[model samples]
Target: RDLHNRGGERFIYNLRAEPATPEFELHGKYYYAQLAPGTRMIWFVNLSRQNGFTGPVELKVEGLPEGVTATPVTIPSGLTRAAVILSAKTGAKIDARLVRLYGKAVYSDATGKPRDLVRYAHVTCELQVSGGSQARRPINTQIVGVTNPLDIVEFEATPSKITLRPGEKVEIKVRVKRNKEFTGPIQLAMPFLYGNSIIADQLPPGVTMSSDSKARLTGKTVEGTIVLEAATGDSAPKPLERFPIAVMGRISMSFSISTNYASNPIHLTILGADSKAAR
Candidate 1:
């Protein structure tokens, strides 16, 4: 629910935003690379947790130049999400700073008419901004243009949070996207560092611990799991602990490419002998 324009400003038109309703929600990316001549980019629009908004909903791209266009897509009822492609023709007006992007969702009510909703965040690129400069990385879908954007290696965890006391173990399901498209084995891991310094005596995540440390991503599969354990029979009181985690999806396309996906710093806390965890 935290929505803010990153590295740039979002534009607001005089259009009236629809009142917040319980029907459906729309989400898009914010950052994208500068478009070159004669090329296009693909991004996603996701609508989920639907209690209403049935029937077809039209998607539109706002704030682009004359030559650049977003292929408007309509999400049919009962479907959750779909992709929209944005392209700049070989002669499209191009400006790295002037051209910006966002998305809007519109749906009709029971009377079979069309209406408008507020402008919502539209997905652009998997981006990283350092020192006021920016870089765009490809994610989810493949990019096939001279824009030269890099691919993103990220993962989303099923049950993102886990809390267990000493002597307990839990399994966290990991699903990765944009891993190098190869047929080899993948290694998923977690950081076992204590405090700011790594436990250098044992390098590489999960290797210092029990069998729950590592896993393999099978053929064309995007799923894996993380098994965490608090050593048994050791009731010594310790501060809450956190770790950084990522998965290396092994593929045949290149050399030592770190197609690694990570998460926000995940922590473990022993609230008591029997407290439960929530996502």
Candidate 2:
């Protein structure tokens, strides 16, 4: 008997069955199942030997929550590969199954049924808040891009980020303190440009230097200011693009005396609109 049967009667009969035909046979199966939020999945099938399987196949997945959509699945011209992107909303978890249904065979059986395949992947993400309370709060964290924390470099200064209208001048003061003690004839040089041009040295028309003779080289003390004047133009000067300046030199030094000294760069800004309108 091709089929087996069980019975308690004296005489019993069994039914016969045959194996599935080649035309109705399924080739192979694969699946891309559970995925995390903002994740992707891919699927493919191999059909190199089958000559009649030359058409598109329908792909579908179920159990996905609301607000989630699946991408269209298509088989390439010469290759049997398909891809899809599965994006999930924030604070969402994805867990689902995929089902692939094969179309009717071109040659014989005309029997097409769906095959089940299971696959899974997971993802975890941390939220980042920008310019919010969490960002404003201080936390213990190490800096990544800096090498030297403490390195002595030359002194430099630039205009602050504050906005300056046309004809407006800003004053910036840079102070430099000497690390070692020395005494000699020093010359103080300041860059001619600060924010806006000096207008032929008119911004601070009155540039002067003052210091106490005792503090010159004897390590006593000295104080002074370098003043510049801005030129009066038909209209206020355009917004300052770049301002550069440097101060160097020793005015005087005493005999057998070493002193530590420092210099300050002072900048004064004039509002040409106010001054010009006033004039």
| Per-model TM-score versus the true fold | 0.36, 0.24
Alpha-carbon local distance difference test for all models: 0.46, 0.29
Candidate 1: residue 58 Cα off by (Å): 1.4
Instruction: TM-score for candidate 1, please give it.
Output: 0.36
Clashes of each: 8, 21
Candidate 1 — worst ten consecutive residues by lDDT sum?
199-208
Q: State the displacement of the C-alpha of residue 111, model 1, in Å, after optimal TM-score superposition.
A: 9.0
- The digit string of per-residue lDDT tens for model 2 on 46-151 reads 3332434444343334455553454544332233322232333334443343333332222234456543322221111122365421112222221111111111
Return the lDDT, model 2, position 119.
22
